[model samples]
Target: MTVEEIHGVRVLTVPEAGPAIRGGADALDLVAASFEQQAEFVVVPVGRLDPEFFTLSNGLAGEFLQKLVNYRLRVAIVGDISAHVAASNALRDFVRESNRRGQNWFLATPAELSDRLAGEVEAGPEA
Candidate 1:
């Protein structure tokens, strides 16, 4: 819904009120929108995603994220998923590894995401 540049990272921030994103189709739709908007990243609120997305066993997260990566678009799931992480060690690991990879990030807040992008900018495009 809203597209803007944050710390030099052009991002398409999905609106909380939009249609429910259930699977890869929805992910692809977002990818298309990102391209149209010339955004390199798609930042979706954690609440906008399905409950299964938080459960690594469900594979929805993998399926959905793969689509975005395939299109060369990075994704950041922004918001608190602390409860979800607390429940599953695999998810905890997933989130931690995702954060390090820099392609897919599980950030606690938009402010954190902004800080992340700011760091990336300072690191330069070669990073």
Candidate 2:
């Protein structure tokens, strides 16, 4: 794991080589990792998450995301999730709405995350 600040958004990035995250327990560990760094956001590579993570019907995403929301911690799942998105309209809609909300984002790259934070800063406190 690595922690860095991009455009004043403190991000805790999970290592690409890290173990696959399977359930809420594993997801919570990632959130917990942020506390030590005082990071406001977490960047987890798509490869780290289990296949079930993308299946909204399975409820893992909701469970894990709810935990992050409860902690007021933002997160970006960085990578190509096109396959998963294509597989289910619910997931597609979920990702779309998540990106719109700004609390949780489905990003294609870390640079996109920096750009999103920049926009949020410019949008001010209402954002």
- Candidates in order have lDDT scores of 0.91, 0.89
Give the TM-score of each candidate: 0.95, 0.95
lDDT of 2 by residue, 1-127 (tens): 8999987888899999967887778768977899989999988899999998998888988888888888899989999999999999999999999998978899999889889999988889886
Quote the positional error of residue 127 for candidate 2 in Å.
2.9
Name the lDDT value of residue 54 in candidate 2.
91
**What's the lDDT for residue 74 in model 2?**
93
Predicted candidate 1 versus true structure: per-residue lDDT over 13-114, tens digit per residue: 999876667679999999989999999999999889988888888889999999999999999998889999999999999999999998899998899989
Question: Candidate 1 regions off by >4 Å?
Answer: none
* For model 2, the run of ten residues with the poorest summed lDDT: 18-27
TM-score of the candidate numbered 2? 0.95
